[model samples]
Structure formats: structure tokens, C-alpha cells
Target: MKLINTEEAVGHVLCHDLTQIIKDVKKVTVFKKGHIVKEEDIPVLLSIGKDHLYIWEKQEGMLHENEAAEILYGICKGKYIRPSDVREGKIELIAKEDGLLKIDVEKLHMINSLGEMMIATRHSNFPVKKGDVLAGTRIIPLVIEKKKMDEAVKLAENKALIEIMPFKKKKAGIVTTGNEVFYGRIKDAFGPVIRKKLEEYDVEILGQKILNDDPEAISQAIRNFISEGAELIICTGGMSVDPDDTTPTAIGNVGARIVSYGAPVLPGAMFLLAYCNDEIPILGLPGCVMYAKRTIFDLVLPRIMADDKITQEDLASLGHGGLCLSCNICTFPNCGFGK
Candidate 1:
């Protein structure tokens, strides 16, 4: 950094914040750090100080903070994500539409591992709306080493470290299992619960069927829904380990590849995930989902709607934040249930 006359400061970057104060009226920053002084800005600088200004001197192997922030933004940017204007060497990535947020945790760790730069993001695989700040990036200093920024860029090459997958418009089919519901011995509560959750996304219930605890009938119903253009199939009830529970067997009978039959989550441990023909997802929800305000289904449903393939590892990792507090008000997604 070097001191120069306000007139000569033009074209140079401000090294510190310039404050303008007025008695009880206002106290505001005239020009912030990293702002490139323009000819038009010289007068403002003179009005604030009237003499010399501290400005950053361009040097080899070094970059201004604003430039470093732009580099960081470019590295992590992906489809359906927009970046905010740089301010004080920081830039925020914003969602362009309502969708599910996906973060490459390994790549994010790799980038942050390189010293002097940082990127902080919201939790991965969670729902986000338009204008929400998904992530923020900045350098640790007023100026950073060019080589360090280059190394960070290289780590993020060929793929975005963060992305938002918009929810797809889908036609969903519902299957309510259990002889009690089919035989009218008890009221069916699962269908309404599933439908209420589906309403939060871009999904429409194409049709619904009530079936007894017959695997053959359940299997045939699943196939029929797929044939009738249902993009998502949800089979509620009979997901437990009881002798009569047969949702998992029914899903397998229909030739769907079961990703997982159970998860390390309370209130929804018996949740089953299967993909029909490697395309549509068929979920077998446990009875706990009918009563619990939040469950593993709430955690994984957004990812499914976004068309994200949930792996066994992904489900396994959820155990870290899988247990719901079951708060009276139930502030899910915002709570620690699925972080």
C-alpha cells in the first residue's frame, strides 16, 4: 500500500474504508475497501479528507480482494444459482429459483483447506427458495497471493462446488396399504399426511388405491401406476418388521431396485426407497410419519423431487443429524432434525 494525492488515487483501489460523518444526521461509508477509485470518485474523496489517500499498489503474484472474490464466485457457481455484487471483498451466491440445494462437501472442504480463502454454505440436500443466500465466498486478506487463488480455482474446475436443482413437475400416485384401512376397520391417516407433504413441492396426486396386506395386489398396483404415467409412487403403511407388513416385499416384487429398506432415523426408520426401471422412485413410508411432525421422509423427499439420486452413503451420513427433537411447534428443516 502507498499514500497518494486524491487526484492521483483515481484508478487505484481503496485500501481502507472512507467514512463520512454528520452531527446526529448520518454516519456512512463514502467508499469501502477494494473499491476502484474513478475520476468521478476523486471529488468525493477530497470532500471527505482534502489531501492524501491510502491506496493499494498493484504488484505481481498478488490480487485485490474483489478480484479474489470474483474468482471464488466463478469456481463455485452452477446452474440455477446467481451471485450477489461484491461488497467489502465478499460475494454471496443466491438461489435463482425455489429448489433443492446440493453442495459437494468434499470439494468444499478441499477449497477451504487452501489457506486465505473461505466459502460457507447452507446444509446440502435441503430445500431453498428464490433469493435465499445459498453460500458466501471471500478472501481472508485485503490482497491474496495469485497462486493461492489459482490453486483454489483448479480444485473447482470442470464442476461447480454448489448447485440448486429445481423441483420437477410430477404426477404422483398414492397406495394406502394395510387390511384395516382396506377393510374399513380403521381410518386411513397416511394418505392425507403424504398428500399434505407433497403439496409443498411441484407434485400432483394422479391417483390413489387402498389395498390389503397382499404383496401381489400391492405389486400390481405399483406397476399399474407406473404404466399410467405416475412419476412418483408412495406406498404408505406395512413398512415394519411384523409378519403382516409386506411393503418392502411388494416393492421388490414389482422389479424396483431398492436403494434402502431402512434408515438410521427415528419415527421413520422403516422408510423404504426404490426406483422403478431406474427412473421413478417408489417410497414405502412407515406409520410413524403419520403422527410425527418430521421424519426421514421429510428429509429425503426434497432430494427426490429434485431428481437427485440418494445413495446408501448419503442415507448413512444422515445419522449424524437424523433424530428429530419432536418440538411442540415442530420447526423442521429449520431445526436440527436434518442438518
Candidate 2:
């Protein structure tokens, strides 16, 4: 690219976008890339502080900013992920469907550290809707060395660094257990809360089972749901250490392998996660889930819906940002309850 003074750029082509900023009013691209500079545009370019402009020039071993952005997008784009139009040397990766967003943080960091380029994305392992911006790739300069962009792409190996895992399993069953709610002593509040939360996802509510604090009965209910083609089973209550709390025991008795009996998160310390035949997930949510605006349940439900298996190590890693502040105006999932 060649640089020329704005007054002498009448017949030249702009290699990059020239932005105009009117604070509190507007910030727009007055002169776009590839725009043929006309005599009438000189005063406008000067007003926007563009005393000099870069003109596009074909080079043997260099890439334009827009071209470099496509390579960066290729490094991060995966299935169910699509790219936005290249604008001002930037391209955004948008979700093709509502799903779980998985980011290779290590590879992303290494690419960003290469200098002159960057890929900014949302927190990994979180839920994202269709049309959500998963990430954006931008080149710092109007032009960059082809070798530098090649180094960025090579760091991703053969696989894309960013991915969107669409929700696979959808059939869900809820089991509410507690003597007080089972009998006429108290109303069943847990079932409603669990149901409302499940409504956020695209899943079929197989049914809700209200049972007493009997481990055998709870286990049988779980088995029944699985036999009825339940993809996910939720067991609420009976998660405490008290003698009457048998939710955890009932889940284990169902022949399901436990993933993590507890997590390092607040408002959900007694949370239990187990899998039956390594496919069907049975979650034993603690008392906090019945009332807390955001808990460990909110953190992991997206992974379960997307069929992204959560390991014990996944639960153990939530210690860093697990505490919920319980703000007056709750903006969960957006806030860091279990980030």
C-alpha cells in the first residue's frame, strides 16, 4: 500500500476505512475501503483528521487487513459457526444455531500473542443463541506479512479453535423427593422451580414424579424414566447430609457412575452429578437450586443440554468464579455466578 496526502488522493483508492466520530451523536465510516477518492471527498477526509491515506497496492508476499481476517476466521470457525462480512478489517463468528460454545483458550491466547492480530471470544463452555457473536477476528494494521498470518493459522493445528455444539439430547424427567412435600405437610415448591428453569431449553418434559424420602422409591422412579426414553433426569431435594436426605444415595443405587459428589461453587456446594450408562445424566440438585437465582446448576445445564459431557475436572475448575453475589437485580448467566 502507498501513503498519499488527502489533498493529493483524489484519483487514488482507499486501502482502509476512514471513520468519522461525532461524540454522543455518531461514529460511522465516512470513507470505506476500496472507495475511489473523488475531488469532493478531500474536505470531508480532512475534517475527519485523515491527512494521509493508504492506497491499495498488490504485493507478492503481503496480505491486506481484510484478507488476513479471513485466515484468522478460518482458524477459529467450526461446525455450526459462520462468519460475518469482513468490515473494516474485522470479521465476527456467529452461531448458526442455539448451542454450547466451546473455545480453545490455550490456542487462542497463543495466536493473540503473535502480535499484529487478535481473536476475542465469549467465555467458553457457555450457552449461546443462534445469531450470537461467538468471536471476532481483527488485524491491527491495514496490511500485514503473510508469514505472520500463516503462523497464526498454523498454531490452531488442523482443527478450528472455536466450536458450537448444538443441543442433542432433549427428553428430560424431573423427580422431586421430600417427605414434607410428598405428604400434605407442605406444598411442592421445588418442582415448579425446576420446571421453570428447564423451560429455558428446548427439551421435552417427560413428567414430574413426586415421591417421599425413600431411596428405593426414588431410584425406581429414575429407572422408570430411563426406560421411558428420558435423556436427562433431574432429582431435586434430599441432597443434604441429614439422615432424611437420600437423593444422593438413590442416584448411586440407580447404577449410575458418579461424576462429582460436590463442587466448589456457592449456593450449590452439595450438588451431585452422575451418569447412567455414560449417556443419561442424573443431577441431584441441592436446596439452593430451589431458590437461588443462579447456582452451579445454571453453570452446567448448558453442557448437559448440548450433550457435552462434564467431567470431575470440569466441576473442580469452577472454584475460581463460583460465588454468587446475589445482587438485587439479578442478571444471571451474564454475571459470573459460576464462570
* Top TM-score model: 2
Question: Measured by TM-score, how close is model 1 to the native structure?
Answer: 0.89
Q: For residues 1-339, could you state the per-residue lDDT of candidate 2 as single tens digits?
A: 998888999888899888888989998888888999999999998988889888989899999999999999999999998899888999999999988999999999999999999999999999999999999999998899999988887899989999999987489889999999999699888888888888888889899999999999999999999999999999998999999999999999999999999999998999999999999999999999978888899999999998999999999999989899999999877887777
How many clashes in candidate 1? 0
Q: List, residue by residue over 86-137, the lDDT tens digit for candidate 1.
A: 8768899999999999999999999999989999999999999999999999
Alpha-carbon local distance difference test for all models:
0.90, 0.92
Model 2 misses residue 110 by how many Å? 1.0
Q: What is the C-alpha RMSD of each candidate to the true structure, in Å?
A: 3.5, 1.3
Q: For model 2, how big is the CA root-mean-square deviation?
A: 1.3
